[model samples]
Target: MSDKKHKTLCAYVEEELQVKDAKSFISLIQPATHFCEGCGRSVAKPEDVCKPKKLK
Candidate 1:
């Protein structure tokens, strides 16, 4: 079993935001930074990111 836990993009953002309000959070995430595993950099859209599969 792997010791590392997998988190969605949203989950990772939420952790960075801490206890911010909904409105502020929404505003902050309006332009979310999605990392492209293939390119190894940030992207404009989540679709550009190479998402990992969920372990069943």
Candidate 2:
């Protein structure tokens, strides 16, 4: 989706991320530094998620 707003873990496009950017997703998830309070998705950087809450 070209018109997608934010490029966060929670905003991922299934086909786009799975097929094209799966590696990116995997890397973003492991060793995650922050997790989204809104969607429970984790990412390396706070900016990579919607509601980023620091990992304990």
| lDDT by candidate, in order shown | 0.45, 0.77
**Quick one: best lDDT, which candidate?**
2
Model 2: lDDT equals 0.77
Minimum summed lDDT over a 10-residue window in model 1 is located at 47-56
50: Cα error in model 1, Å: 1.5
lDDT score at residue 25, model 1, on the 0-100 scale: 41
Per-model TM against the reference = 0.26, 0.70
Q: Runs in model 2 with CA error above 4 Å?
A: 1-6, 13-16
Q: Which ten residues in a row have the lowest lDDT in candidate 2?
A: 1-10
Models, CA RMSD each: 11.1, 3.2
Task: Judge candidate 1 at residue 34 and give its lDDT.
Answer: 58
Candidate 1 lDDT tens digits, 1-56 = 12176434355444654364555445433455655454443434565345632212
Q: After superposition, how far is residue 6 of candidate 1 from its true place, in Å?
A: 25
- Please name the candidate that would achieve the greatest TM-score relative to the true structure: 2
Kindly list the per-residue Cα lDDT of model 2 for residues 1-51, writing each as its tens digit.
354565777667444685687776687688888989998887888987878
